[model samples]
Target: MSNIKEDQANFTNGFYLETHKRWEKFSNWIHCICVVTFDLELGQALESIYPPHVTLTKQETLNICYLAFPDSNSGCMGDTNFIVRLQSCPSKAVLSNVHTAYNSKCPPALQINPAYYWGYVYFRQVKDIKLPRGYFQKSVVILSRLPFNNLFTKIISVIAPEYFDNGNLSLEAACYNIDQWPTPVPGLTLSLPLLGSVFQTFIPHQRNSTSLILQLAGLNEVATSSENQIQASVEDLNLFDIFQPVLSHIDMLWELVITAEPLIVMASSPNHCSLMVLALTRIISPLKFCADHRTYFTIHDSDFKQFTNKVHGTPPVILGVTNPFFAKTLHHWPHTVRLGEDYGQYQKYKLKKNGNSKIFDSTPGVYSSYKPFLQKDKTMIKNLISGINTKRPFEVQSALLKKHLLELTHSFMIPLERYIASLMPLLKNISPFRAAPTPLPFNPDDFFAMLETAGPQLTTGIKGDWVGLYKKFFRSPNFNGWFNNRYTELALKLQALQLQALSDADLKLWVQGKPEVEIVDMVLKIKNKIKKCEQHDIPVSHTIKEQLEQRLQDIISSLPDDLKNILQTS
Candidate 1:
């Protein structure tokens, strides 16, 4: 045990030592360039807000004054000087503590009078030890009055200047009153202990492919959770509820980044802002589904007078057509057109029983109810089947279903997308790209895996064969009684399989290696075979039929006793 402990301690010490050495090497190579310098006026303004006494350390104070307002020959000024002042401040601990408080169960009070805020302070360092080659390192500090009116508003003015047209100086003034200062300044120095380390270590280290990849993977995990949560919540929300919290959260996250580094606002290019807005809009857009079913009905009078004009021989009554899954709210049309002329004598008899009839019945002997009623029902069914068959031939059905499902998946992905978009301005200024581009269209493998894992209710007996059912339901033209019956059975089985997959691992194993063929293709092939069989019109030999029946019986008998009973019963 002692040896083990010693070994562990030695390993940890060695690891940290290596890490420290790597950091030192990296830092040594960093050519601390003064990219921007503020004049003494700006330095005085900054000091007035923070006071020279509230600095990271004596060295940091000197660094801020010297680097921020360096004498001539110092290349640093403007944006760079501001960033340096922020970097030199002892505000990390304060900022971090504030962040913690904001996130805590009981948030601490951070009073900032928006009107008193001056401009921001920023500092930059270049990571090129070698002459003439390096990326810039930046830090930003916002100098504002305590007790902010709206935190996000302040951040937008200080960090995201491209969002509005006001000049940086004017925006700063508008964001806060420059004159008001608390008589006794709130004695608070909130800090984030790991803020500097995060910037120095995590951000820069992630410049390499390996670290960046890991960071991206972590982000994906976060995105997945956020997306799923948002999608699951969308159906339960009203329109107002949907955008409000989402927009608010986005605003908050943007502000957090801005407050951390004010230069992030100024450094943001217009293109970056536009891209961020576009990405955000795409992420938040609602998913829409089109309804496809259409229903047409008609009513006729005994006098052969049509209430509505006839198409061919049939009078149209109700025509309810839709795209698919998209349902509209109902609208009522109460007034009847051509009311008195259309009713048959017998039809008028029914109406008179309920209330005093105003119009007299006419053409009492002309109507035959039975034949026409039956014919209309038969025609309705035939028309429905014809419509279904007509639609089946077009590739639109499959495309539409796929499109809708993809939309659903995209909807599920929105929250994560929004979160990432919110981070874009900071990401763009700090890195090469803002955020990951919208993901490519849904992949079959990933989709199937998601269905299996997240949608166990979708599983069926024929694992791969379920794809055929999907095609048939979505793509088939004639959904006749026979087809409907078969389809319903298969759907139920699929649903059962999905449920079993969710809760019963053993059942999931049973349907492995199922085929995934298009159902429409299978149906067409079957139809062709049936047509060929009918054309020949030859009865199967008794011997062949007997053999097939025997084989089927044998297969059924071979099932386990319990399963056999269940199958037989079902």
Candidate 2:
């Protein structure tokens, strides 16, 4: 009788799970949340895998733990958060479409197209005296392709600390809340509530914003940021803490970032490694860095063979590694930054090249350094030192450094931005008949010549051979990305101008002398114009689209009875 009852209970439980468990899948922006904790007998181990049904290979779990934990002298030293950017070979289902509030009654879209999953992992750790070793070390990792570190970290920031004291209940609740969020469509800023706190994320409609920022809405705040306001990121990238140690060498580093040089940053721990990598990637603002960079990388990652092959040398990857093994392997690379403990020290890098292999027994300090085009402000350095001596809050000290860097980057970019504007054709050249007016040619010679007359050195407050700097920069990936974006933006603007003019003019006037075939072709072009504007998310395009669409129908209606059938076919 007991056996029969047990079988009956099992059947009921299985039936409910099969029908009602769809809601328990991973979050939309998040792939999976995992708990990697220290096991007494097994050492580092994965304590729990969320969703209860997901399976991970033994090797994958081991690597997750290795990446989740920081390699420092004092293990589980303090509560901290850092990203672990890894290349993973996940199962097909793991990389499925983003989860929504799953409805069992509703069939999912028949297509099961698997998107490539890039692991944007959030690692958090804490300690508890009540645990086995007086140190409760664990990492809560969320795997996803979205590089919205500022957003996801905030969620894990709450979830991890709570889970350390409480248990899986908080984690489950947060996951449930995230799973219910809207599809995160572009141009929408959704106010997501997780465990009583409100967070905001702006899925930008266009490429106007360079980064994704998650804002935590304070309940007692007098007001919230208006939805229209687009702030790049609420959290400062990596804080000012990383820049203080290498204040003197900052100018050279900025040059390296802009030039897209392959550099390695080896630090004592994962926190410093990841933080420094993030900070370096953002030094040049307005002009986004185009090179590949890893925030935190380990030897056990799937990309290990790709990154470490001696025959290939090193690709142009700005890597942040904690393993000392990279010292020998990557010695052949162009530049290597050796960061001291707590990021307290840094050294200039130089390369002694012999067919791009480590030919000489030299310390990692041999990269070609460039002098700053703009003079360094000694006063700020003095103030920073004074702050450190007087025990100023890290926030205050960091802000000062960030301000200086921001100013420095802007000064460098002003000359470029000004020169780029001069490349645009005059407004009088634009016409309604053309699909889009092209910008004037980007002649390197003309630009260099204009720099002198443009008062570039004076306008930018950057002294030196401005021409030489431009020559070097124009060849770089950083400059390429900026130049492309500038031209593309200008082109889109021209397209919009043409559409705007078309909206005002009578379509019948333009089509009077045109053939039916020509009119049909014109209609197709107009359709494409609307689609392009929609893709680019031009605010005025919607109005113009309706106008063009209506005018097309009117032209068709006015056509003679014979051509009307042909127009209808079109």
TM-score of each: 0.18, 0.74
lDDT of 1 by residue, 125-209 (tens): 4453653334333333443322221221223223323212222323223212211111211222111111011101111111122
Question: Residue 337 lDDT in model 1?
Answer: 12
Which run of 10 residues does model 2 get worst, by summed lDDT?
103-112
All models: lDDT?
0.25, 0.62
Which ranges in model 1 have alpha carbons more than 4 Å from their true place? 1-52, 56-98, 104-450, 453-570
Model 1, total clashes: 51
